[model samples]
Target: MENESVLIRYIKTKKGLLTVSGILATISTVVQFIPFYCIYKIIELLMLGNYSAEGLIHWSLVSMGSVLVGVVLLYASSMCSHVAAFDILYDIRMDLLQHLSKVSMGYFSQKSSGQLMKIIDQCVEKMESFIAHQIPDIVSALIFPLIYVGLMLMIDWRLGLVSLVPLFLAVAIYALLMGKTMKNNKVKQYHDALEAMNSNGVEYVRAMPAVKIFGLSVGNFKRFHQSIKDYRSLVMEWSNGFRSGYVLFTTLITSVVLFVMPFGAFLISQNPQDKTLSLTVMLFIILASGTTGPFMKLMYAASTFSNVNEGVKRVDEIFAEAPVKEQDNVTAFSGNRISFEEVSFSYIPGSPVLKKVSFELKPNTMNALVGPSGGGKSTIAQLLLRFYEPTEGTIKIGATDIRETTIDTLMQNVSFVFQDVTLFNDSIEENIRMGNRIASIEDIRRVAKMARCDEFIQELPNGYQTKIGEQGVFLSKGEAQRVSIARALLKNSPILVLDEATAYADAENEVYIQQAIGELVKGKTVLIIAHRLWTIQHVDQILVCDKGEIQATGTHEELLAGNPLYQKLWAINEETKEWEVK
Candidate 1:
């Protein structure tokens, strides 16, 4: 595979099919010249004053038969190429998807959903056009001209040389149309504009609610509006630049006979009695027009190369990314105790979010991370779940480094519930089952009841079968949080991480969710990241975090009794509790 072209490597599985297609296309192109040759023979016979019904009929039938055979071969060639093209597209997309799954979560943070979608959908699809249509067209176009020009030269070298004048001019015009500037600057700009438009359009849709609440109009949404403007301007600029050059190329290619006719006429007059020479000039007149078809196809194929090449390079960029490294010799853990030994992390280099942070969760004990906003509580939970690796130092479960075990092995032991819940547009039962794929319907019901979502779920029109998201019933914030708990409960992992699980809950829902959480954490080591100090008052240990460092650790009573940051947080929490809307 080394030094192989991206396109050829992808299509190698169907190389034999493409080879067969190319052979058929070449034969079809050669057969297309039969009608021209037949017309020439008929004209030659007439000029020599040789008249016979059999001779005319024989050449006419051969011309018609060659055309029919050519049509059949061309059809076969197209079929083979199209089949190979679609299969290769499927393989490429699957490979991309599998690779994406193995990459770090950080990769997704940097890429927009729209950008990835364009690469997977539009960029990959671009290859289909090149492989299916252009490959065969290019092969036939290249062959047709060489054969046509060669036969003309054999008939009359003078007329053959004249026929090439328009072809040369047409090729020159085409070259200017597909110059380096058009390829590197214009085409790249067009794709960039398109990607920007797509990304902004997605952002605009996702923020539709905020826009409506703020009374914002499309014109006021500057990002989306500017994207549309730039896209329109680039398209106009591209089309205008291409329009004249394409017109000139087309005129030169199609009016090839005009280049041959005068020269042909002058040669005919040079020896009017030379019937062979006269017939040859007439032959060039009739066939020169037909030659335009292949040359025109060649121009079109060459023009498309820039766009397809650009898209292919974009696709290649995705394949060039490195996925998350996995352990070769996976180490087995001996217990449920989780420890972070002076672990430090940062999403970007040189800006530490967790500086020399260390903590231990004794097996089966409950712990809470209570901190102010931007104090790295959520980051600690994410680090434990291996959503990201520590920049320095080790995170171990029972004495084994988390990195020494496979991701699957690490994830199986730890369950995390995020502040933001993501539920698919699927049945409530299906959504919960994502936590445990092989869980039976009865097991799902048991966990749903434990998470306190079973009551509301049963009240829905279709109960557990009811779908969620846009096309179905939308759950309230608290109801969705309960459903997320139901998933964690089903997983029943040894350790759990709750990241502000009750942050969005109402008082009544919070009571029910707490009762559900009481059931979910039984016999499991737990870590709760909470902003509400009152919610974590009864935890076994409270770790006070501030400015990327663990400042203090104590029970609720001890922290409020001594630590200033803890006392201040508690005072603020108490004040907010007594506030009223009036």
Candidate 2:
């Protein structure tokens, strides 16, 4: 795929915006000469008017018309540029998201949410500037100065040519200054890193309780403040560099104008050989001097150009990433029969997590995945649903290898209830109905009752309509879990995966949730990743995963008698339960 972003490449592909953009840029470029033309016409009226009333009115109206036209063109130019910019940005965002779907799960695991946010923010901001203002502005800025210079040359070649001293000097200084500014690429890197840290820091700060529980929020305030200070100091350094560069460039430009331009004007005026009246020589000096608008701005706009380029590169990388697959073919699953063969995986190379692990799950069978930390039990469930591809093996759904099938095809018939549930800041019913958006109110109430959610949901101030707040903070942890289960039940997929959703729940609520799980799993192929021993006792088949391979796979009684690791884990969990009761 081309590295060019959708904003740049899309217009070429569509050619729809190209015409409008060209028309707008042309108008802006032509209107740039209005100021030069007006200056010449204004000076003529004033010089030849003879202090007449009608002459003053004539000049005033002409001056007013030029000013009005310039204003109108500038405004219209800005509007057209902005329109084109936003249109491109809209297309780019959609394309970016669509490409993101192809990116493998490993890519997601390797990136931080904060870093992702910065890429998104910077991309949109830079593309906006490029499309809305920079392209046309750069074009007009470059040509306007040349246009002014050409007009002056037509008036008097010697004076027009000499007036270029300031423009050349300014450009020289501007180029040198820009070189110095470009040396601060390190500053850009630091800024992006800081933005990522800030984004991650803010999210964690809001979830302070979780951090405190895990004893992880220790260096937040100090780290965040220091980062802020560092970012401020870095920006200040870049600003000073840019400021010195601009000032030096503009000063040299102004000096050339003051010293060289007027002297040339005098020389041209003193020419006794040709007497068309040297009036235009003076006009040439003023108009040619106006060329510095682009010259002086080069130093400033160059910084924005660099920053925008960096931003676009970051966004373009994401937009260019190969997605998982494009599956416009939304196929439905017939029935869920999960299978794994010669499955091998490693989050990091040379550190294998699952090696040659194989498993077969019969349709509508309840199986419990029992394992210690890092035992790859959760990895199995994640693979069964194609959250990731096996590094060296095959996982199949029905008769098709998951990779060969579209993600939507498998996912449409699978519902996942994770340990941590993050609900929206909307109504309870809305969150549950997210599974089946068009589900009727009666359907929502029916699923809630089945999942034991209606009893508490009805207790809320507005019942189904009550806002849950972010992550459903308005409800207790137990209630959130119930809402999650209700969602899965509403989804009513053929296969369901539960990741210890009952872990932090109280005894009564845990029992209630377990009952709801049993109901939901009645006719579905259920895969459970259990952290505790008691969870697997009711499962039809229990796989005791020690490291990567399943050491034992059988009923609870069979595993307890035959598998040593299974026995040890069972005894340990029983002791812990007894200790809890004591």
What TM-score fits each model? 0.90, 0.87
Instruction: Pick out the ten consecutive residues of candidate 2 with the lowest summed lDDT.
Output: 272-281
Per-residue lDDT of 353-384 in model 2, one digit per residue for the tens?
A: 89998888899999988978888988887777
**lDDT by residue (tens digit), candidate 1, 1-582:** 655656778888899999999999999999998998899888877878786989999999999999999999999999999999999999999999998877777777888788888888998888888889999999999999889878988988888888888888889878877884465598788888888888888888889999999998778879889999999998887788788888888898888789888887887788888877777788889988897778878977886777888888777777777777789876778788988899899999999999999888899988999878998888888888777778998888998988887888888898888899899999999999989999999999999999988989999989999999877999988999999999999999999999889988999999988988999899999999989888889998899999889999889999999999999999999999999998
lDDT of 2: 0.74
Report the number of the highest-lDDT candidate. Answer: 1
In model 2, what are the clashing residue pairs, if there are any?
Answer: 102-323, 102-324, 103-323
Give RMSD (Å) of candidate 2 vs. truth. 3.6
Give the winner by TM-score.
Answer: 1
How much lDDT does each candidate structure score? Answer: 0.88, 0.74
